[model samples]
Target: MIPFFRKIRQKLLSRNKVTRYLVYALGEILLVVIGILIALQVNNWNEGRKQEKISDQTLQSLEEEINEARSNLEKIISFNERILELSNRFLAGELTKDSLENDPTQIFYLTTYAFTTLNFAITEQELSTERTILGRQSLNAKLRISLQDYLSMGDLEELLGNFWNNEVLPYFIEKKMMVVYNRFLKQESINKEDIQQIVNEEKFVNLVATTNSMNYQFLNLLKQLDKDLEEALVLIKEEEHD
Candidate 1:
């Protein structure tokens, strides 16, 4: 193709067809420019496709993570509700010290009440890739932007960590809840009056309140995350089919 164009130019120059030569030269330049533009467009299209594929994969991974988050949130909510029940019962004298003394349900909630953070490890490297994908999504529909907001919040995980580290575990230590817990664990005979006295204390009540609050917070985030996951899955499914 190059040689053919060169031969044509040579012919025009030899004939002193200056106007024709200039026109041909201009036409050649225009063709070259058009070719370059076309190549750039193709390259851009390819890059976008690559990023979209990465984003799709990331969304799928997020769905899995969201499922885990939802599961954790559900467990937390149930446990918190149980604690709330226990608290209410103790205060109302419905759950006597005798009942509290033998309550495995209450013991489990207190012992394993730490935050279980969701693993976003899949997105560690894919966030930059997802920004474009997220930006292009519908925010109102809990699409990409909503997912972005959910991811950015990280509140559920942080809430659990804060309570466990700053309040939950510390309260147990500072308020001697742990001592009561240890006594329970040691299979020692707990005086029914002492158990009643312990549950009715200000510290134990406060812990119950905090636990309920923490669980509620976790549930709220998880609900949103669950919605976001459904929205994301719909978007991804449509994209995949398209």
Candidate 2:
């Protein structure tokens, strides 16, 4: 192809067809420029396909993580709900000290605490970087909001832990109520007076009330997280089709 064009140019030059030769030279330059542009376009297209494939794989991994997080969240929510229900009953006098004394295991339930430990694929910083990579506005927004909600639960969990360590545990120790917990562990019968003391103590009741309130807040956040995860999954499914 090069030799053929060279021969044509040589013929035009030999004939001193200067004007036609200039036109032919310009045409060759135009063809070369067009070819370069076409090659760049093809390269760009291939690169785009590679990036899209990577984004799809990332989304799938995120979906799996979200489902696993949801499963864990469901179990935590159920456990805490039981604690809330039991605490409410005890506070309202629906659960008598006699009932608790019969089943020391019930004391274990009252003393138990719930803390948020849900995990997710998107971090605060990663969300922004992922937005640029994934190029899905709705999915990105959902992820950002969901992660914020999820991270905020950490504060509530920390508060609950501090309350248990500082207030509730101290009260138990000061009142010598640790004996009740020890009896629970040994599966031994609890002393009636100790049971009555725990059930009737004003400070203990207040502690249970405070924990119940925190549990309600934690449960609400978990429920919102569940909803956001569901929405995120839906968005991922849609993108898969696209």
Candidate 3:
């Protein structure tokens, strides 16, 4: 191709058709520029197709993660409801202390179980990969922003960790203390004064109330999580349309 263009140029110069030669040269330059532009355009389109495939894969993975999260959340919510039911029965005196002490249901109400059950583990790498793919400036702008906001605000791992440590753990410790004082110590026929002394130590009353409140708050948070997950699914579906 190069030799062919050279031969044409030599013929044009030898003819002394300067005006026609200049026009030919300019036409050749334009063709070259157009070829380059076409090549660039094709390359860009291919790159975009590859990126879209990657984004779709990422979205699929995220959907799987979201499903897992939703399932886990449902389990947690169910468990919390059970705990609340048992606690209410105990509080209402419909369930005797002895019956409560012996009930297998009591085990389900334990904060330790809640901690273990609700502690949904997620790897930072998964989130980072999702964010990187979604962060591309080439992505649909609204979709990119939606993904960013979800990544920033709707972190399952962080929410689970905070709920377990800040809310669940302390609540469990307080409940254990209460069980030891109100049930075990009382069973042992410990002096009322001594039991009172134990209850008075280290903000025991405050802890018991806080523990109860934690269960309530956990339920509330679970509701919020369910809403967030539903919203995320909807957003992803919208992105698919675009």
**Which residue segments of model 1 deviate by more than 4 Å?**
101-114, 121-132, 139-179, 183-242
TM-score computed on alpha carbons, candidate 2: 0.89
Q: Summarize candidate 3's per-residue lDDT along 1-242 as a digit string, tens digits.
A: 98998899999999998898999899999999999999999999999898888777766765676677778878877877776665556444564435544433342243322432332223234344544355533333433443443353345435545655785556446555445434542444333333334233344334334444566665666766666666766766766677
lDDT of each: 0.62, 0.80, 0.57
Q: Rank the candidates by lDDT, best first.
A: 2, 1, 3
Query: Candidate 2: how large is its RMSD?
Result: 2.5
Give the winner by lDDT: 1 or 3. 1
Each model's TM-score, in the order given?
A: 0.67, 0.89, 0.64
lDDT of 3: 0.57
lDDT of 1 by residue, 23-60 (tens): 99999999999999999999999999998887677666
Error of 2 at 218 (Å): 0.8
Model 3 steric clash pairs: none
* Two-way TM-score contest, 1 vs 3, winner: 1
Which candidate has the top score in TM-score?
2
